[model samples]
Target: MPPPRDTSVKSTVIPFDPAAPNARLRRLVHHDVLERWRAADRSAHAPRIVAVPGGDGDDWAAAALVTARPHTAYLKIVDAVGDVPTAVEAVVSHARDRGLAQVKWEGWTVNPEVAALGFVPLSVPLAQDAESSGPGAGHVRWLHDGEVTEPPYYGQTTHFTCGAVTALVAQAHAGELARESFDRRAELTLWRDATNFPACEPVGLGVAVRRAWPSSPVTVLLDTERPVLLDQYPQDEQEWRAVLQRASREEAGRIGVPIDSHPLSMTTVRSALGRREHVLLLVSLADMQGFDVPHWVLCHGAVPGALVIEDPWTHTAAGDTWVDAHLLPVPDLSLDAMSTISPDRIRGAVIIGRTEA
Candidate 1:
């Protein structure tokens, strides 16, 4: 059995000096908590760390670590200031500053106040829970049948690289990324090979997969009809979505992945899985926590009515929790809502096929 969590943290509030370096922020929060945050910084997908000063004394008070996701920033509270209510206040305030959309901390099970703070438990969603209009089951039970997993879980170095990371995981699933560890070096290599510099388009991800794993092939699927939300461009809103899609197609073809002028849908995803091929799909974070940016995930199996997803970014601590949501089933209903390309809502996907042994 595991040991109980420490709840004896107590500190006096102290004002922060702007002139001071970030190293000083560590002295303000719990040493134990800061220690863990330090460890997280070593990873490629580490959070952007910061601290909110405590008042009056030298005691380190409130601290949080933030990371940018699809369309919003994710804030995770590391050290609480006081009782549950007070501690929650510290978190909410910091998140508010960044216009944060999703909030999760470690201690939700013990304190109901965390819920009262408009925060929810980072529950691992299952496929069986969501109602679907498609097949029989709603989760990816077949992933556990010994056909899916291979290279295993490795967190992304940057939030924008989820597509690249997903591609790597997909390659691993196809036995193309054979290695002892898909560590920071491997992740950066994929990112370097894939990134469209400013935007993370699907084609860039497909391109990276092909460059890194020659044995396995990926198809970059795009809608032949152009998206109409052209006006929404450059606002960090919808304009870039169209830009990336066009660029992804052009670049995907340039990189040699079978670029398809066909639209993507649940049928496309299912067809790939049926052929024992892995899919790297783009989705919106808004449907889950109200952010509207393109995100990528690996889809390996399906339940009766839903697709099984293994997200690159989960609530796991660094390497502590690698494979999250083995049973993470995305019902057809919720899946469609999130998988559609922004503004245009056109479906897009990059299906990774088996390795040539």
Candidate 2:
């Protein structure tokens, strides 16, 4: 058999400090990329740098940048002068210590060493465009067994199409839409049908989904009566958007769609997922991406302490690929906090049930 894996090699974890520059880290990552990492560090999902010392103990033989969500840790960047296996081991150890369920590595390219360490390649559908494919391959290693079924991932081709992409993904998960049809054309078409100028309001998107697939049952939950996602627009623009939202709500009522005028609770969301229904949640990306912008995400499943979600938008600049966005795990507490929007604390969700035969 092959030589026993090295167990003696240990790694040191250092919190990334933008102010203090380390020669070892600089050698692995460029100055500009380091600045980007610093900005990400300031975000809620701050990353830490892990370094494994060389045999001579004078230089780092391997280094990796990593961050932890509620249930998983992402190996954002990795470089090894030698002993790639050791680097993987060090990162895995850190993830385990953090009480994470899995460790994800999105490599710039395929590396056999990572696969040798029991990291399985995540199934990514062929992208119609290069930007959706992202820059690299994604692999994940589970620390423990749990039910984490990932729905089909579809990256938004444009910035404003998250809502449409998420709605389509929810439909695909429910077998209402074909996975093959999840392309830019479908995305934009759905966006045009659902969007209130730029952003897709809850009622507008719900109405669009209901109209697109009549067999699929939809229920919209919103705690407010005011027009949402219009804060950035001026008075005249807001008025027209409000009128559209009002129209959408009226259409929803006429079509037998249940529009609940209350906040969406985690308990209710869990119940719906338990029934195999998908939830399109409106959340502020402040905690996840370090921004306060409202974004749409699809909730597909739930594990013991976390809920599984699919975020259509990926932070490509921070090395996030579809792996980071697909079936992402967020803690119950964190999801509840992020799902509550600001100013009015608006909580919105569109529950899409399985299509009827």
Candidate 3:
């Protein structure tokens, strides 16, 4: 392969300004394929962008998107017109300023040069890592330690209903129904009931719960009013914001849940667990899926240095399908890092079941 083109680029990292005139988000995203979260995805923390000075009388050199999630400020997306190393430096500088552990790149979609940089996946690449989970594997540390097992495993049949499947697991654990009876696996009726199609968001499923059980004590908590997956992301913030705001309002009004525009905490989640409250949590799957995306899993209990998760997605790695999905223990710091919906959106879990009178 030919050596990467070098243009003696000088790049700077800046917080993405969605409201700026002639904002370059749409064009940038098209260039940065691995950057998962769009402006529509930013219910709270908008990601930072890298800007490079134009060379040879050119208008620009390069641009890229980076995130501020706890694990690492991800550097997986870029629109390069010059030296990639300079752009990488700009992203790294921003990550260091934020006091993050590392800068991550895409594991699945990494090109040859990016792969040569040798950034591993933020979390274990697969659910079953033999080295990580060997004879003394931490993954098996919480196997039978009374960490609220019996929630049962029912994977998502469709790609979009991770939220619904996670909710079902929580409901079962909360005594809304027994595990076996609740195994609807892939029938997708529950997801269809929960989701707002076309937009592909898992909103208003809480209303379905109340409808099924009139006396159910489920409380739906939402932290943002942003419409999900909007038009492959609009370059104009206001043009996008109008549609986002409208959808959020409609969804919130229809679901009848109060929409909070702030962060939630893991401590709150722990408190709910203490009261035998099972929770459906919104987490970034950067660790699991190789880039940041909204994913839901049922939190069974907290163990030493980790949280036990009952993931709704089936483990893709063979022979360890059930082994990996059932009560998977993610490292505490890693769990803490991934347990958010947005940068500013803390505690993105919806606590349901058995509210006090």
Please name the candidate that would achieve the greatest TM-score relative to the true structure.
2
Candidate 2, residues 190-294, lDDT tens digits: the string is 999999988998999999999999999999999988888888788999999899999999999999788898778899899999999999999998877777899
Residue-pair clash count for candidate 3: 3
Q: For residues 6-49, could you state the per-residue lDDT of candidate 3 as single tens digits?
A: 23335666676544512444433343443333223431234566
In model 1, what lDDT does residue 157 have? 55
Model 2 CA lDDT for position 153: 75
Better candidate by lDDT, 1 or 2: 2
Q: What's the lDDT for residue 15 in model 2?
A: 80
lDDT tens string, model 1, 210-255?
7777777778776644633244455565565666557656765676
Backbone clash count for every predicted candidate, in the order shown: 14, 1, 3
Segments of candidate 1 deviating more than 4 angstroms: 1-151, 224-251, 315-327
How high a TM-score does candidate 2 get?
Answer: 0.85
Better by lDDT, candidate 3 or 1 = 1
User: Which ranges in model 3 have alpha carbons more than 4 Å from their true place?
Assistant: 1-147, 183-187, 198-203, 229-256, 315-320, 342-347, 355-357
Model 2 stretches astray by more than 4 angstroms: 1-9, 16-45, 54-56, 59-61, 68-81, 125-133
